[model samples]
Target: MSPQGHPWQKQPDWRILDTQFGSGNTFLATWLTWLEDADHPRLLHYVAVCQQPCSASELIKHFEAHPKLASLALELSHHWFGLLPGFHRFLLEQGQVVLTLCVGEPLPMLRAQQFEADAIELTLPHTCQDELSWFLKAIAHCCRRGTRLVMRHADAAETPGWPRVLTQCGFTLEPMKSDGDDSYRQKPSSFSGYFDPAWTLQRTRPTTKTGPLPVLRCAVIGAGLAGAAVATSLARRGWQVTVLDQAETPAAGASGLPVGLVLPHVSSDDCTLSRLSRAGVRMMLQQVSELLNVNRDWAPSGVFERQIGGTPKLPLTWSSEGTQWSANGHPDGDVALGSGLWHPKGAWIKPAALVKAWLNQPGITFLGNAAVTDVRRQGPTWVLSNNSSEMLCEAECVVFANANGAFELLQKMKHSALDTQAQESHLPSKQGMLGLLSWALHAEPEEARFAPFPVNGAGSIVSCVPTENGLTWFMGSSYQPDAQLERSDQENHLRNLEHLKELLPSLAQKLAPVFEAGTLHAWKGTRCITADRLPVVGPLDATDQPSLWICAGMGSRGLSFSVLCAELLVARMGAEPWPIEAKLARSLEALRA
Candidate 1:
């Protein structure tokens, strides 16, 4: 849908929305037309809404009749099953074309989604318009100033004043060729300008620049899930990312664990973390399947979580059937959920492997044993250095993902930096004093050192984590707030054993032999947390951070939230549509809390 008398030409990052995606005909036609046009948008976000979408086979079978749409429909069929009941995102043409299919009533779907559409297409009957009101309301929510609306009325003559109604919805109708002839004023006339080139700028897409995103270099501290995910995301966007960590290799921190569970947090109110977790998990499922070995490095088969002290009444969305567990089912390993819900999409993952995979991406490089002590803004670049005053590296963009170390560094940078012109005045953390300042400031990290906001009160448990020995279960990552990496592994393992005893006594008893034999394995790693458990995913200012950003404080949900947080960070940096909503993005803003 062009703006002026221009024939539609290539316009990168154009959005085409179909209010009623019936039988997939409109989507197919638009896709084919886009393919035919040499000047089509570089990225086409085709959002389709269907109230009761047919099954993939049903839709495919119907398309078989149309030779023109067969091939495209077949390719679409592969990802068709992903369309469950709500929103399903499918990437095609290597992400050039993205299809966000909403399987629900049009009104709710449109209301839930936030996007600025360049073109809106709707087909209505010529007779009485039954669902016209709600449709217009939903359309208005997503339309921008220059958005063009295309309406096809079967009986334009019978539907008297349809164009007039459109005007009330803020849509100016261009003149149309009467029932037989042509040429009028403003109305939803023939599809003349619908495909014509009227668009000049790719305004909706995320890229603040006038042209393509420039080849940029960035340095990400920490090789754990958070840092690796951020590095991977930026690299995917053509940014040269160097992932530096003090550890010898990636995922050597909490992300180094052999197995981590990926599941959604459910709550009656569906708290922010719950919502963020679900979205994060949904996105992670795709990334893991694409990047790591399924069932080996990753598994989406499902998970069973046994609640203790009574399952915190889950939201209606998490209600599952068929699989019921009881904390007493297995007397030997007796941890029957008594009636725990099953997470069909919940899976176990090797966080270490995933981190390495991300680090291997085209533009990503991992620097091991490279500990970055502090960062200082020097004009346009940030200078990173080791404790010995040795320059580690410098880049225009610097992201802090080294967990609480980031918090410590920030505190050092703030309290120590003076208003002097000399380099020594810029920052002290780069020197040995940074560490001394941090230790002196909080020698006994108060109980409030780094804690969850509102405190989840919800403890964590890991089960069925694959390790060097065999399939092992890990539980109870005791939130030893401010407890750095000094805790003994044996002590934490024993602590975890106690957690099992409290969570599921019977199972604890069944596994008593391991404790008796001292064979119970455990690991200790610090989890970066904030006032809220959600990761600080955006700029430090909640808005602008030309070169500085943070993707930390994931707590223990690092595995579940890494990919989503990474993508959100990238979208923010590149100015693209976020994988989640705007409000949710705000909730995860690093500086918001």
Candidate 2:
């Protein structure tokens, strides 16, 4: 309550921060409290730092012991296993509740971020006595005037950052009823009054919008996986989304692949791609679990990545189910001569089903066979047109999400006013012919030929797909720049069969009849690839432009990456808290200026 005898209230956009996320008990309590309070904030945001999170199974066990938290804890456990040293966002309660978990040493994590906290829970470790001042200073970086903080320790008087450090950080300590409990409130201070203020003199501050200000409407071009995913995310957020595709059907591009693996990539240096893939695989799994037929269109059969001759050393050791083994040991006691990384969460997914499902969301309209040839920004709305210059639709914001077509559509949108010939002349030209089959061309292969788990080697293979015709294996995706669009060549089948033979010699030999008969299933679709070979997400222009966004360049990982890319794009558009760390978000930025 305020001094004026009125109830003091906090905004529904309440943000709480914890210096330490020991086991997420603070988060669970707060969440339960929110669930019980009808007037609670519409968005409950919690940010916590942890050096090392407990294993997923352990966390799940801890939560399961409590009957109240059993269900939600199980949900959390699904996303709790990422050991990467970065921020991980978990969307709970359908994103109304958000948990941003940063894995890093306390001081470094706090120093790297700039956000205002309405409530702070100081649960710093007692062992870090030498760096007490630094920790307090970093905590102050996120504190604003009027913020309330509570610290818990075994001995209140023996806290590493005593009253002196708290005072130095502009905190007014108050006596608490419990001896081990210390409470404080942010003291009144000028912007520059605090020592080592976070802000620097600037003409304008950066905008970190967390939700739509006034309107939520967009036209997402391309009905492939990326576009459909973007459209679905926006539609889920109450946005009216219109998805346009040049083809008669969705996933008619590279996303048309009948089967693809959602496996994480690992590099010795933990490269950006590997990190992005890990996070991406997690995001896709969430969507897949919620929507899509398990063991039919998709399954968590896990993926084994074999490292053959001259196998490069990975930054992290290979381990599955907590059992670490190297190639030299062949820990599984297999005839295979190389060590492999097992992605238990990674699995095979039929891309087309996902694309169709995503587009089926309420408020999302898919316009197929209505090829979009040009786009232009009017005073406020973005106009779409066909190749005949016929108007298609107009909307406030436009998202380019069609694989390689995104690159071309954006060019048309940027120069829509110019003469058709002039526009073509100004457009970037690429003359290349690329490889093998796209779209599932089926052949009946014996069911036993399928593997117990999906195998990802040079090309890859998926087993046990019950298609309309018969039981078949979808394989042989040639990542070639010289391949024609939507055309399958028998030679590509030979190549795919050869790659399959290399991965599973005995199985390929058993399926030799199908290979020799040129009856192996295949698909032909052009995959969009950035120079970096990573998905391009976020705004096309970084200057906070009003009407342009992009989610393309998915390449071969379309199934694995489309959901996250779409998630980020929609989050940015609707002003929602991003689902991934800022560093990673920046890396996936549209691959443009």
Prediction RMSDs, each to the true structure: 10.0, 5.9
User: How many Å off is the CA of 541 in candidate 2?
Assistant: 2.3
TM-score of every model versus the real structure: 0.72, 0.81
Per-residue alpha-carbon lDDT of model 2 for 248-296, expressed as tens digits? 8888877776677887776777678877777677778877877899988
Over the stretch 236-266, how does candidate 1's per-residue lDDT look in tens digits? Answer: 5567888899988788877876667787776
Model 1's alpha-carbon lDDT is: 0.62
- Residue 486 lDDT in model 1? 48
TM-score of 2: 0.81
Q: After aligning candidate 1 to the native by TM-score, how far in Å is the CA of 257 from where it should be? A: 1.3
**lDDT for every model?**
0.62, 0.66
Candidate 2: where is the Cα deviation over 4 Å?
1-15, 38-43, 63-65, 114-119, 124-133, 136-156, 160-215, 316-332, 336-339, 388-390, 415-448, 483-488, 574-577, 591-593
